[model samples]
Target: MKKIKNKKIKLGISIGDLNGIGGEIALRTFEDERMLDFCTPIFFASAKTISFLLKHFDIDIKFQGIKTAAEALEGKVNIVNIFDDKAQIDFGVETKESGKYAIQSLKSAVKSLKMGEIDVLVTAPINKSNIQDDDFKFPGHTDYLNQELEGDSLMFMITESLKIGLLTDHVPVKDVAEKITVDLINKKYKTIYNTLLKDFGVEKPKIAFLGINPHVGDGGVIGQEDKEILIPTLEKIREKGDLAYGPYAADSFFGSGNYKNFDAIIAAYHDQGLIPFKTLSFGKGVNFTAGLDKIRTSPDHGTAFEIAGKGVADHNSFKEAVYTAISIFKKRKEFKKLTKDVLQKQKRRPASSRRGRFE
Candidate 1:
């Protein structure tokens, strides 16, 4: 990990679906003065797209180009125009031109992240079907990014009060069963455990894993997934000293405040976790990408294309996403500081005693 001086986290933005409310919400989130205090927001879209979005929404925030994060002015918004080519950034109009631009913007943000130009990334919603390239695959940003990073990245629909993590996102119901394996469960739990401890400052973060089948397989009468796959994984993790539990019944887990009892909930599939989750935090929930090398967040909702140019889209989820990214960046910094102090103290102790003398 690259270490630098403690400053506000710089946000690298990907403006998705310029025809939709993505640009509007991104502009609104950037215009907030409080957000500038936490981090400098940098837009990875072009000048034309920015102007089109602002004009469509009729917002009066003036933005300009900046060479680097340090060049961002106090009052004006900072933008890094990434695209060299130009397209008609039409509002309420969806075209391959728009789709291609959206893909380019997202790709540029990923490149910036790899180069360490920004500390965290906050994306607006994009339609998966819109992005049409021969090589472009994956249903959503999370999947595309995870494949790019070449590791397991869990999708968590987040609110401060509760969190729901999906074991399988954007997958067919029939395929979900084949996807759930002991190794996958163990990997996801490890990611959740490490994230809660590092990002949330929880010393012994308790995360519960839910079952894939109805009534948690009811001892294999309903399904064998819980009994054969999930249980063995949970047991192995517990034995390794991770604070994890449950092959809980999917029916009662959320309604019974089971999610409230833990730091995070891991579900068997997408709808299983998100159904109850969205019911609780629908317009307010933020989608977080965990287990990536870079911190990333986005509004859980989509680009309400039907409501484009109407000034009717709710900005709550986008606002929450930006704030969530800032908070995660801050917490990640703290986690690093705490880990460093811990290691330094360990270095001071006798090697033998440090090994045997548990804290």
Candidate 2:
């Protein structure tokens, strides 16, 4: 018998909420022996909590404390323990201790990512209201990435091919209209376009934009945003030689499987895109933070606080999230290589010859 080599993608994960499904799902996702072939998952949490989880769930895996990331084993479970001995976390309670631990884990994971210690990141769902305190005013992960990276970012839902991006996340209904601006729309559209082309390797990506008003305002019969904001944005994208289209009513657009017609859909509000997207893709969609410095993905579902300790919470989304992160990593790198090859070839070709090919 030959001894095969183990090539695994190193993953950095943040324990979302110790009291919720974050720990349980994290434990279960790594329980498989076959996982050693794909990626070496490095979880940033406390040693005590992870041990408690393994015992509580009867999960047969050991969490060894690795002092530094460079010491992580390639084919075994390695943990970077935060050593939070102060908190006695209950199974279902959300105390300040849980919040503090969650924040610390996230901060540690983000730092490791910045240092290029980890190639990709797969995160469990964190409770926004609890983990982030008064000084931390960001709404969720996307905003957290924006603040951390010091740049703009957007959240897009990924369930295989059907991608949906929100124009306004965590905003009230009254403010949704006010948030629709041309510059913001253009910024998000570019993210969607570049992600499809560069990440997914779509030569020319097609995107459909959803409207805020019912029936797309029937030519301003309801609201003017469809004609004023969305339509103009679509036109601009089309002019720039991208296959972008639509200011369709959110109702009919989804009913006809119109979402499948394009590579991604840009929604004008949070629920406008996410509700239908989650409905169609619940337990599968991977929440991708577009326009980030590095690849960051999370399971679309929440922490499942109600089913924290019951061992019934599904790890489907978490598995898919990890798989998606790995797939995106490979695909994007391949595309980047392809782009590099093409550009080098073009630069080496004669100007007249390159113009002839375009012509």
Candidate 3:
């Protein structure tokens, strides 16, 4: 990690579907001048499009137009003119043009992130359906980033109090069981454990896994997946000195308040985790792509076409996404420093002094 001292982190922003609430929320988030004190924001969109949105939404704020992310200045909201042409802004509809522009913005911001021009990335909501073409064939941002980034990507939904991860994301419900093999479970669990340690600064984290069947197979009377697959895998994980527990029934896990007991919860499928997470922390939660080399986060909510240009969209989640990305970036830097210091100290110690007896 690059050492950053006495300087604000550069935050890269991708303007999602222009027809959706992406532009509105991005503008609303930086409307407060105090946000500039934390990090410099660079929006990957043209100044003309932003100006049109600003006028349409009736917001009064000044922003600098820069030709590149490297030209971003601290204490000012910057716009990287990814395109020079004027965009057609359809407030409450998705179009091919909107999709194309959204992809352009995302690719530009990601490129800057890969080149280390930006310290972190907080993306706005994109209409997943329209943002697909020949070049981009993934279901969503997590899938695309999994290929572009170094480490495995886990869709980790986080709030100040609650955190939930999915064992299988963007997979059909019928295929989820097949996807949750021993290797997949081990990989996702290790990713979550490491994310808790390095990203969230949690030490000795305890993770709970939700079951695949109702009542955890009701002692093998309901289904065999929980009894056959999840149970044995979790047992093996625990044997390896990891605090892994449960194939608990997913239906009542959140209702019974058992989720509060663990550091993080891993759900069997997408809806199994996100339903409760959104119910509990809607408009406040952040979707963090955990176990990735680069820091990326986004608002938990998607593009609200109904409320696109109404100026009524809530910016809390987007703001929290920014804050979370910055927080994780700082935490990773600190963790790397601490681990490096520990390794240095161990290397300096003599072999005779390092030997210890269990007795």
RMSD after CA superposition, every candidate: 3.5, 3.0, 3.4
- Which of 2 and 3 is ahead in lDDT? 3
Quantify how close model 2 is to the true structure by its C-alpha RMSD in Å: 3.0
Per residue, candidate 1 scores C-alpha lDDT tens digits across 1-359 of: 89985566678888888788888888877666666777778888877767767776777777878665445555457787777766576667777777777888888788778777777888888877878678677788998889776457999888998988888888999999999887788678777777777666778888888888998899999988888888887888888776787888888888877788888899889999989988988989999998877888999888788887788888889989988988887788898898788889999888887642111
True lDDT of residue 38, candidate 2: 90
Alpha-carbon lDDT of model 3: 0.91
Instruction: Tell me the deviation in Å of residue 209 in model 2.
Output: 0.6
The list of candidate 3 runs beyond 4 A from truth reads: 1-5, 349-359
Q: Candidate 2 residues 76-109, lDDT tens each?
A: 7778877547446676777777777888888888
Query: Per-residue alpha-carbon lDDT of model 3 for 194-308, expressed as tens digits?
Result: 9999898888899999998788889789878888888999999889788898988888899999999999999999999999999999999999999899999999999999998
Error of 3 at 341 (Å): 1.0
Q: Could you tell me every candidate's TM-score relative to the true structure?
A: 0.92, 0.93, 0.95
Stretches of candidate 1 off by over 4 Å are: 1-6, 67-75, 89-94, 353-359
Give the number of colliding residue pairs in candidate 1.
0
The lDDT for every candidate, in the order shown, is 0.81, 0.81, 0.91
Clashing pairs in 2: none
